[model samples]
Target: MSNVIIIGSGAGGGAAAWRLTSKGLKVQILEAGPSFDPLTDYKQDNSDWETPFPVKEGSQGGYIVAPLQPLTEETQDIRSWSFMNGKYVPGAFRTSFGYHHVRGFGGSSLHFTGEAHRLNPKSMSLQSDYGVGADWPFKYEDLEYYWRIAEKISGVCGPSTEQRSPKNDRVLGTPHPISYASQALAAGARKLGLTVTENSLAVNSTPQDDRADCNYCGGCLRGCQRGDKGSIDVTYLRRAMQTGNLTVTSSTEVLKIITNANRITGVLAAVDGVLKVIEADLVILSAGSIFSPQILLNSESVHSPEGLCNDSDQVGKNLMETLLATSTALHPDKLGSHRGLPVDWISWDFNDPISIPNVIGGCRFSPSMAESDVVGPIAYATRIVDGWGKDHKRNMQEAFGRILSISGIGESLPNSKTFVDLASETNSHGLPLPRINSYIDEMATDRLRFMMTTCRNILAAAGCAAPIEEFSSIDAFSSTHIFGTCRMGNVTEECVVNSYGQSFRWPNLYIADASVFPSSGGGESPGLTVQALAIRSADHILRNKGVQ
Candidate 1:
């Protein structure tokens, strides 16, 4: 029997394994996708330039996304925002959803842009501060220590304390210089009296832990070929293996969790291709917000008619996704916006709810060019140019190295309209595919509108004649940071886990992923926090069961 069984090898699971194995606990990880070796698999140095990155979601990388719901079309609608007689107006933009996530040894971090962010201290108290989303059980100060630890291991590069980001003040490593496009955006933001701060990225700016620094290749989303980008595979999982107490099983899809009375006994999974039950003393669900709850819901038995660890029937409730809006403009100069890091600069001037008067939550925008893949001439032809042949070629040439994009990340308040559940159909693995339904409430829409307008203003401030606004309040199914399916709170009936990510319903069964986040903090990337929570959960386990 394994000492501990973690059902994923992503950010949360990797960190949990690192801490537990370092402390002398035998750990096993079952992942649904194959792992990759950066040296051979990345191939960024030799890849053909014609190939577009971020291959269709779930189509490649063994990551399957749930079918889009409620609203299915990808076309821009009026409900979000549109030009009415050359004036921007809100139209009937229905929210079509597409989850962009990679399921592999390192999970979504394999393709993530590596922006390691922490929640704004005030954002941790959404219920107390803004009355929109629920408040976290603990304060930012409680998690700061863990954030620092995650950053150190991940080799995060950022501004110093004196030049700290609004979200985290204790950043360690130094950040790279802003891209030319970002420099323009910064100048524009400063003109508007907004402070554009350096981004805290989980990329090595200097050699650390034997990994090379970033070469500014601008292929972050395609998976970093160089060991510089701090994906969990190279950071936490590598450390866990160094302890020699961790075993990672790839291409093992979970079927259901087996429980004996009030505690988890093991997990039934398809190991490679064979179905088997792996026994364990403890089980940690790190399969992300979607699959984690789906596993619980599929674990229904005579004892748990609904599901294990789901007495509150909140297994798949309160599914919150990333709320986003962005704009792009054509610059006069070939700023070479694609060479450096994707989003080197961000602004938090309007990151406070109080700063926006009636706005209940906050939002942030960044100068995103390379990270968005708005760089290559091919990208210009496909994304910016509308025609074909000669005209298109000329337009592409005109737009190359001249595109500037500003994107906003905002908090999506948990609403009854948005959630996930079991669908009637099954996936290729025969498990019932999770059904996700998402909505954008008026309050959330207000935030999206603010972000849209703000991005456009920044572009204009940067001396661009026209900044095309793209409002995704009801479109652009960017589930970049999913959360709150199995929420954590104080009340047992109202929560799925405790402050330390221990499940309330089942003993020795814990969740250390985005599934346990009570609320989606304001525009913060969830990776670092996921690691911190998992580490904390492992420590809680150590406190109860003894490490050795």
Candidate 2:
């Protein structure tokens, strides 16, 4: 038996493995996705991007490729609950949400674009800031030192002078030089009075922790072959294994939690279709926001008939997907090369106080990295909603590489009404899967509206053509930075976990994923926070010699 068994190897799990293993505790990481070695297993084929098997119905959109597989399957149509006309109603629409996540080792961070931002200060006090969401157990100041630990562990890089100018801020290293395209966008943003700064990335611009520097090839999305992106596989996971106290089981699916007397004794899992049981003194659930809560809901033990740690009935609530909108423009003047990370430059002025308070929600602006095929003098960028065909190619040639984009990231409030619960449906294993019922709330909607208006003005001033903006009212979706399900609070009556990520119902059970978030921050990417919180959780466990 291991001293600790961690479910999921994404942001939180990876961090906890390193923290606990370094403290000489036995740690076993059970990952449903296969182990991927960037050096040998790098594949560009559809299999590398495809979703795993055991496809379930009501998945609406064909399941998105889990991080493990990299292929697209036949798409599907589905419906979701919508908050319209001041009421919750059912609507018909479809999306490829699952496509954004990955299953294999390292979790979704393996494919993330590496935008690292801290949570908005106001986000910590949601009750005071907006009066709509709940307050966090801790504050931004509470996690400052841990944030630094996370940044160093992840090898993050950004502008030193600018990023560290704030008193509450602490950065790890300097940023990579800007590409020609990023420089141009920064100038244009300055011209429009928007604050454009270096993008805070969880990638190494220079060698750190025995890793190499970024080569400026801009292959972040497809994958970073150079091991410079600082994904978990290259960072914490590497060090955790070095401690010789970590055991990683890849391609092993966690079926459910086995609990007795409101405490977890072990977990039942499937490895290559073979069911097995693993017992541990402590269990930390870091299986991303969607799957973590889903596992709890599926595991209905005698002590927790509603599912483990779900006595509050807030297992999967307050879901938040980053509010994203892209605006494109053709400059007709080629700015520079586009062969680098997609998000080299970013703007933070979307949090401007002038109109942010009254907007339906809030928005954070960032510089859009240039795309390779869309960067020449004769080019303009356009998003083709329809399938790409000959006509699309023709349009592409007309505006091949001249388009520049500006984007906004907004926060979603914690709404008990928007949640995921066990559905009447079950998977092939006969486990009750989760049914997500949610949509963009008013705060998110208001933020998107403001972003559209601001993007248009920024483009006009940047000497580009009018902007093309996409807005979603009821069916909006984004792939990056999904969080919140098993939220943390000071009391068990309201939250599933405590501030240290210990389960309210089980002393030996913990969670260290995005699900522990009380509310998603407005501007900061959850990656840094997730890592920091994981470290903090491990520190708490070690100090107390495990949760009481």
Candidate 3:
């Protein structure tokens, strides 16, 4: 049998490994971080007060609070807290964007919110329909079946009757019960001529894949201890390992992709401070948008001095950092924000490709509970409350169950100016760190403004008493949906990989992550799409290479 090495065990790598191994191919997965088991690592039944909050080391050696404050107990897990977390060299638009990703056995999938949304067909054909962004090498119809398979594998649940796109035919599992926050948003959306639909989530509603149903603990980001959330680690990766054809090596960092002529021969990796070479006929780079390209760039050789698949210098050029806009308002009625999933509803009114102008994407608005515990007191003491003592206490009491929030997740287009390159600095393993340079363009700014306005109106219609408050611009820390460093296209000059995610320069190397996305769909979560594409890539590999 032909041996395959898949780097990173997130949604993309896990899905690809599952598909390949199920077909009898031997697969080896190398993860840069330690293995994370939610059963043991997750803090079950622990409140924010019980968990130890993250504290960064000060320059003077004392401990200080981390800049990115997490109000949940999951932050207690180092694996979940460091999800997509990496260092970057400062460049143009450095201040505008920040990179946040998790590194571990499951990658960012371990800590994701589990929203599985399919891209609108129009978004797949961006150039033909919207006259912006590069069109996908293949249409959505080609991957529709894979999307269905991905949803099935992940056990996605959503409203069966609510149709967001005509192209989406995959039947979701049992729908989650509508929360008060969702109901309030839906009522407000209806008044404003918008439609609010049940979000397709990977979290279980009625129990599938041997996982328990969601208990509505509102602690999804903290890592689900009950296995209700369908992170690839608990789902596809577990299944793949059970097949006996898959082997996972955790805490092993791939330093370089060893190449012979134009074919990938093996990977040079550092495992527990020891360097070793693992042989493989095929290599799938699913190390995510940032590190995936970094690996390729670091794999320079005599035959490929620029990089393994950089004949056209398209390996790490176009980067799309998903834009996020948020709004907060105080509702007059008590909308229990601590009861259900962190994000329980979605509004697709702005996702329409044809109806909106300069709006090629959509946004999702959900109730926010970020300031629930210690942070809540801090928020009232600093900003929300007008006065001290009784005023602060009264404001806290009034806004406890009355505050509602919305986030507008907007689609971002590829810009040549934004990209990931090799930084002068190197990691502990001596591999160069990824230098990210990105900035929000006018189109993204306009879309964010529109989404913020729309979200404010929705909150107003939902009976919010206070004026909507818009928070800061989208940054790397706030935005986790990173796409398009190694984009796929019909031609190698314009993209890094082909439609099957195979590099034109090196046929044995494939990519199966958001890095292969030609265009970021209008506000749709990339988790499902990444898994779908990974499944398709596995099929392509099987068809072309066949079982040895």
Candidate 4:
């Protein structure tokens, strides 16, 4: 059995672990953060959900190699976001790098909203079809088979009747009832000649995989306490461990990838502050877009001084920080926005560049007030209701369940200005943090404006008052769905990894994360695709090993 060492425990790493372990490979997962017990460590009931947010990311057991931000919760603070300055424009793009980066055995999956998505065909072929973005090395059809496998493993829920391109033919479970705000948002979208469908969520509607059906009490932003949400910890990692072929070591930050003679030898890591080099027959990197390339850059040596697998000088280039926007207004009636899954409904009407008017890439929208507020009185006292004594209490009561917010995610083509590089500052481990320099060009900026306007209109049509620009999600670099850096392609000269996620220079090194994406899909979540690609990579490794 091949001894595989996988970095990260997010969607890609988890899927890879499960698939490789099931194939009888000896897999060891090294996570930078401590593993959490879904039954215990989750803070669904915590008022300050974002306390351990980006500010103190590395102060814990482990930390992501990202652009370090100040130890403050303003990144997710709705109050800090722009109120539109009484105009339609967003307050301001975020400057701090505050992603939904939860470091642990489950990685960001532990705190994600569980929106599983596949890249639309046009999105995959952005460069071929449109003049914007890099096209995928392979077609979407090639990945469809693995999409099915990933959805089944994730217990993703969606209705078969919804005929969205790249969606699963057989979902593991049914979708939950549309959230209260989504009900109105859907109607408003149809009025604007857009199609709305239930989101393909990796959350339970009916019990499956011995997990509870979603109670839909909201507060998902704090992370799912119950096992209903298909976090990597509860799903893939759990199942992988059950196979007895996978060994998971949390709080073990991979410092550098040690190599020799064009082959991966092992990873230099700090296992709970103790440094050691653990050998492996193969290494799979799934440390998301930021850290994956960061680790590669940090592994500089005489053999591969420009960084391993970066002979093409494309390791940390072509970074595409995820683009997102939110517009919110008070609904005429109490929609109970706090209850139910936060974003149960989504629309892919503009998931292709052709569908968008004067837009370069793809985009999608959904109701997100529930996700923004993160449940009951927490967001109100801290973010929304902004007063001192009795007035604050009254405003809190008024805004409690009457919020209607619309969120949009748009695709941005890789540009030269935006990229991942080593920061001048070093961390406690003396390793430099990955400095994320994000830039959205005029076309992407225009696309971004379009998303905000659409969201504002949706709220207005949905019977909400003039929607205020809730947040631009750009403060620092608050990217939740970042992509690219170690992009995959057919040409070894232009890409870091091959079509099968194998590094072009290193035979035994593979990558299975959003970093390999040629282009971000029309605002689709990368969770499903990340898992699918990892599963496919595992199969490729198996095939390379001559295992049928």
Among the numbered candidates, top lDDT falls to: 4
What would you estimate as the lDDT of candidate 4? 0.79
Residue-level lDDT of model 2, residues 1-548, one tens digit each, is 89999998888999999999999999999988776656445543334332222122211211122112111221111112211112111223424344256666687777677776666655677765656666779877788778788888898898654432335356667887777766766777789787777788988887888888888765566556678888887889999999999999986778898877746889999876689988878899988877888888888867888888888888887776666655566666755444567788777665522237675234567656432223322223224222368876666655554567666676676565566666667766777666665565555555666665576567767777764433332343544566788889897887899999998769889999988888776656788789889999999989889542
Candidate 2: Cα lDDT at 123: 64
Error of 2 at 165 (Å): 7.7
TM-score of each: 0.92, 0.85, 0.88, 0.91
Sliding window of 10 residues with minimal summed lDDT for model 1: 82-91
Collision count of model 3? 8
Scored by CA lDDT, what does every candidate get?
0.78, 0.69, 0.73, 0.79
Collision count for each candidate, in order: 5, 29, 8, 8
User: How does residue 213 of candidate 2 score in lDDT?
Assistant: 87
What is the Cα root-mean-square deviation between model 2 and the actual structure? 7.0
Candidate 2 segments exceeding 4 Å error: 39-99, 161-171, 352-355, 369-398, 468-474, 546-548
Candidate 3 residue-wise lDDT, 335-366, digit = tens: 76546776777877666555456556555555
Window of ten residues with lowest summed lDDT in model 4 = 71-80
TM-score of model 1 relative to the true fold?
0.92
Cα lDDT of model 1 by residue, 1-548, tens digit:
66999989989999999999999999999888787766555646764543433342232322234434343333333233322123232233343445777778788898888888877777778778756778899987788888889988888888764222344367578887887667987898898888888888999888888898999878887788887989999999999999999999988888899987767889889876688989989999998988888888888988788987788878888888888877778778878887788877777766665555577877778877764567776667666677688987787777778878888888777898778788877866777877777776767766777777787888888888675435464554567688999998898887888898888868799998998998776687899999999998999999898555
Where is the poorest 10-residue window by lDDT in model 3?
A: 56-65
